[model samples]
Target: MDRAFRWAFIGTGTLAKKVAREITASERHVIATAYSRNREKLCAYCEPYNAYPAISIEDAIDRSDVDAVYINVTNESHYEVCRQALELGKHVLLEKPFTMNASDTEKLQNLAKSRGLYLAEAMWTWFADVPLQVRAFVQSGKLGRIREVYMSYCAYSIGYAPRVSDPLLGGGALLDIGIYPITYAYRLFGFPLSITCNGDIKNGIDYGEHIVLGYDGFDVKMDVSIVDTKGEAMIIEGENGFLANPGYHYGESAVAKTKSGVDIFKGQRSYLKEFDSVADEIRQGKTESSFIPPQATLDCMRILDECRRQMNLVYPFE
Candidate 1:
């Protein structure tokens, strides 16, 4: 690891720009290439970063200068981009939700493992340091026997977002914003013994949903929506007390409540720390992140698929 890891960005959107800026500012990596559906927009977007505007997605993955690819493409295209990137013998940092369904995600995960290449989900919550602390609190044996978990992530997706309302594009509230709370529940409880979910469907897309995952002795209750939703509280309740985050998706801090006392930790949040972790792992010749494990991403998608099934939500792409 004598030099920086060059990243080829597959999507030239706001998130891509943000990631590039953070990587550059941190001095841990460099943006080597950029690709987008719109060639004109791609060239213009790469101008500020001085990265190569790739001729195609394949060109971006096949670039000799790039050590890895940062895929921020739409939900529908995530599986294809990830598959092509790994096939080209390159590492991949895929966007969240991994894919539209669990089957595609399992295939990609198997591909990455078979290739001995690094593949990870770019879920900012997993990368952020704050959630790690909350996880520690939950696992520290301080909360006693886990009783129940509660989570919710709901937002109103308004205008100009194709992937949120278009069925053909894999747009839905469950895939877009709901997956956060779903991931949190999975992180704490793993796969549930039984799951009962109810959600709204409009024109083959999911508008909102409520899910109850039954465990051995506890249950996980969660709700998400494209329109307004309930409170944003992610808590893991136990016999003795509880461990909570104000929100699961953008978890900014950790809160602990017990009979003796209460403790709260609101740590600093930034995107640099996670990208730095990826750079370090790549330099060490590692393929997957210890923080954002590949299986967790797969299991989260499974839960999402079940929810979609209960809601009878169908996407045109699937």
Candidate 2:
């Protein structure tokens, strides 16, 4: 029998609402409690899902019923929430942009490993089903040594929220929305031999970034920006065929073409995949999630750190 795991949410925001919506759809996962600095907001948010609305982070993690915690708070709060949860012997699934830097990410990963606990970054693409097909398409020899790949995810949000534009909260295009393009390039080709980055900055935050990742065999052109909302998709070109993916961030079903014809792979999965993955890992007493492995998260953080270094993008808190 599988353990129908009880989950605690550390922050009540739009993401928490999303988690609540998805948790009800998973048989093995149920949100047991929720906590936000604003207690009334927390109670109102969790009531629909029958979750105990706690008053603080400590209260949520201290619940005996909570098997794991889903940390979907702001980027700045990721490390602290994850650290506290791990210390309380709770498994953690963190939202993307794992931490302010790779150092914190590595430290948390080490802590989880040492404690024989499970910790996973909630990078939904890793748990999605289409990325497997996307990887297969890249490795199938059908593309025949992808010579050139151009990918961009432009999120031009006018009048963005404070968290999106605040440096103290780890706000920037690279960490907020640019991570998708970087992850795409990293997924197909390993870390680049050389990376070149340029960004538009205002109010100590990067509104947009154009990145060029040079591999030994090929080069990837990636542009991600919140300043310019044009061209919000990805294109991978090879000797034989190319893949056209719109909104590549979520692993949406995409189309690949070859000489014979275009082969489209379509299978839409849910955000619950991450929740299900962690629950099963905890049920089996596993220390790591195979879906969103720790090393991959570290790799992502390392790439972002380097990108920031090149762009001279630094957070006040860091």
lDDT score, candidate 2, position 292: 68
Each model's total of backbone clashes: 1, 0
Query: How do all models score by TM-score?
Result: 0.95, 0.95
Q: Write down the lDDT of every candidate, Cα atoms only.
A: 0.83, 0.83
Residue 9 error, candidate 1, Å: 0.2
Off by over 4 Å in 1: 229-231
Judged by whole-model lDDT over C-alpha atoms, candidate 2 comes out at: 0.83
Q: Please give, for residues 64-109, the per-residue lDDT of candidate 2 as tens digits.
A: 8888899988899899889999999888889989998999999999
Pairs that clash in candidate 2: none
Off by over 4 Å in 2: 1-3, 158-160
- Tens digit per residue, CA lDDT, model 1, 1-318: 457778999998878878787778866688889899898999998898788998998987797889889999988899999899999999998998799899999999999999999999988887876777777777777888888888887767734477678887788788888888878777766888998889888778878888898988888888787876465778788988987787556758777888758978676566777778887888889988988898899988998889888888877656
